[model samples]
Target: MSAPRVFVVENTLAKMAREPGGRNAEAAVKAAELRIDGVKDVSLASLIEKAEQLGVLAAEARASGESEAFGPVYDLSNAIYGVAGAFGLKGLAEAAFSLCDLTDHFRSGEEANWPAIDVHVDGIRLLATLGEKATAAGADSVLDGLRKVRARVMPAN
Candidate 1:
C-alpha cells in the first residue's frame, strides 16, 4: 500500500500576529480556519496531537518537582504564540509566549524567578470569559487586549 496521506495546519497565527488589532481580526480568524483545514495533506495534524502528549510530560515534571525539565513545554507554548502572532492575535500570542519564557526561566536554575502559574492560568481564563462576553454582546469580534498588544507587536499596523 502507498503511504497514508497526512495534513499540516498552516501557521496563520504568525500571519495574524503581524497584523494586530481590529484591522485584521476577521482575516486572522478566517486564515486560522484555513490553516486548520490544511492539516489534511501533511503532518501538522500529528504535531497538534503531540501537544497532548507534551502536556502529560509537563504534568509529570511538575509533579516530580523537576520544574527544570519544562524546557520542552516552553518550546511548545512558543510555537503556539508564533501562530497566534501571525494571525494578528498579539494579546493572546504575547500572553502565551510570556508564559513559556517565564516557565523556562524558572526551570533553568534561576532562583527567585519563578512565575505564578496560577496567575497566568487565571488571566487566560479571564481573557476567554471576556471574549465570550464580547461575542454575546454582538461585538463584531473580540480579542482581549489585542488592541494594545498589536500596537506593541505591529506598530505600523
Candidate 2:
C-alpha cells in the first residue's frame, strides 16, 4: 500500500490569521487547526465502514431504477469523495468524483445507462475492499475502464 497522496491547497485559516484586517483571526486559525487535527484522527475503520455503506447505497439506487435515485447516489459519491480524499484513497476519490459527475449529468435530464452506474458501484466496492492498500496503478486501470464505459454511454457531441 503506497502512501496516499498529500494534497496541499491554500490554507485559508492560516492566510486569514496572517491578514491584519480580519476580526477573530486567531480564533479562526485555532478552529481550522482543530479541524485539521480532527481529520487527521479519523479512523481507517470508520472510513471503510462508510465506504461499505456507500457501496450498498449506490447498488440500491441502481436497482431502484427511479431517476430519484440519482439524488442519493450523488450524495453518497460526494461523501465518498471527501472521506477518500481525507484518507488518501485517491482512486476511490477519483471514481467517486466521476460518479458524481455522471449522476449530475443524469439529473440534468441526460439519459443514463444503468449499467455504467453498476460499474461505478463496483469500483467503489473494490476501493473499499482494498482500503489503504489500494494502488495508483489499480486505480488508474479502474478509471480507464470507467472512462471507456462513460464514453460508450455518452457519445461526444
Provide the TM-score for each candidate, comma-separated: 0.43, 0.67
lDDT of each: 0.51, 0.78
Write model 1 residue lDDT over 1-157, tens digit each, in one string: 8999888889998887677455566887898879865753333333344344445655665666766567776776677566545544444455556557566666876532223443343343343233323232232222344334433433462
Candidate 2 Cα outliers beyond 4 Å, as residue runs = 1-43
Error of 1 at 141 (Å): 17
**Clash pairs detected, candidate 2:** none
lDDT of 2 by residue, 1-157 (tens): 8988888799898887687776585888889877865865455566566667766776676677667778987997888788778767788888888888888888777777778888988887788678777787887899899888877876689
lDDT of 1 at 102: 60
